[model samples]
Target: MTVPPADNPARFLGRADAYAAARPGYPAALGAWLEEAGLLSGGVADIGAGTGLFTALLLRAGARVAAVEPNPEMRAHLEASLDGAVRAGQLSVHAGTSEATGLPGGSAGLITAAQAAHWFDPARTVPEFRRVLRPGGRVLLVWNDWRAAQTPFNRAYGEVVRAHTGDDPLRVRVLEDELPQHLPGGFERHTFTHDHPLTREGLRALATSVSYLPNQGDPAYPAMARGLDAAFDAHERGGQVALAYQTQAFLGCLD
Candidate 1:
């Protein structure tokens, strides 16, 4: 597998609001899955926790959360998103990257990276995860993969992304394919379906929130926007579109 450059943090700079508003959240079933696997009882370190999306879910599942985010803007958005939980001591936000979480040894019983692991250098990050997790602690990697084949709108939107950002090397890889190769121990995987409702504006936000895509001021952005608009007009129903996702989770323990 190819390793992309470590420039994702910079790519997301100044786009925290769009990310928080547009990105889909993990399903509640994830929390249930954790509990069923007997891994929900202690401290959880949510690495690369952007805008507190998965962090919020972990907190609600009755875990003390340490949200480690490298990007300052995204960290601020995360802090804002979980203010009440922070005040209540349910969560803490740290400025840290996946390869250097700055957490104490054996501090977490569970570690997680939701929609963020592709940016990490596994050579560094896998060991860091091992350092922070207690004995028998597990790591979970999660992603909401857009199922383009599920709907015509999805297929069209995917084409738009590919047309504009195909040259970009950044891509979300399957955790099942990469985690076992890099993690100290092999992992197991599970998947579930999730759906998000989007209006035309929501669709626009989704497109702009993608880090690899050209932003509003970029020369190629107008065409991207037109593509998204065209897709929306063709498939929208009752002023909304359904974006289907295959939510994948991979779990493993470190050596």
Candidate 2:
């Protein structure tokens, strides 16, 4: 996986709804892992809570959620989409980022980054995470990698992105190699795996939600779409295909 020298931070903000519709949610097993870790002691801060997807899962698990997302478009979408949860006081949406997080020192028991960890500058954010967490508090970094080699449909889909997108953060696994070395000191690592089913439309929406695609239209976007369509045509069974995921979770405890 080649890392493109481009700033893709604000890319998802432009396609908030597509992101909400296309992106897969966290697996129940990871949720259970967080529950077992007991970092929800001061409740959980869903840092980088884009579109409140992970926030909803945390809320459903009965964890009080303070979702911090930097992009206004994403924050606004989260606010609108999460009204019911907000009204019920299960969730609160805030504007912030991994670096310079707005929460008070030692105020969070658990800090989680879901699919957004790669975007952060770990050198600065790791210490900031330490500052915000109470002693022994945990920082959970998570990602959902589509298993291209696991299924034919998945492999074909992977080919589409490889052929079109220049730099896709979703294309590879780097945490065990990248994250641990990037943040050293006090922390432990754990991993959990899961899979999900997606309809052909779901897969298409997923491709469209990627940051590399054009906001509206681009020559490459349609080609990527066509690649997905072809993959779906070959793999659709009973109106759906199983997309296997290796859901990786890295839990680091602050000393």
Query: What's the count of clashing pairs in each model shown?
Result: 0, 0
**TM-scores for candidates 1 onward, in order:** 0.94, 0.88
User: Which candidate wins on lDDT?
Assistant: 1
For candidate 2, give the lDDT of residue 60.
Answer: 69
Question: Which residue pairs collide, candidate 2?
Answer: none
Model 1 Cα lDDT, one tens digit per residue, 1-255:
354535768888867878889888989998887877778787999999998889988987888999999889999999987999999998999988888899999999999999888888887888888899998888988888885236777787788888986734237655454566455687888888888889888888887787778777889989998998898888899999888888888887777
Clashing pairs in 1: none
The worst-scoring run of ten residues by lDDT in candidate 1 lies at 167-176
Specify the highest-TM-score model's number.
Answer: 1
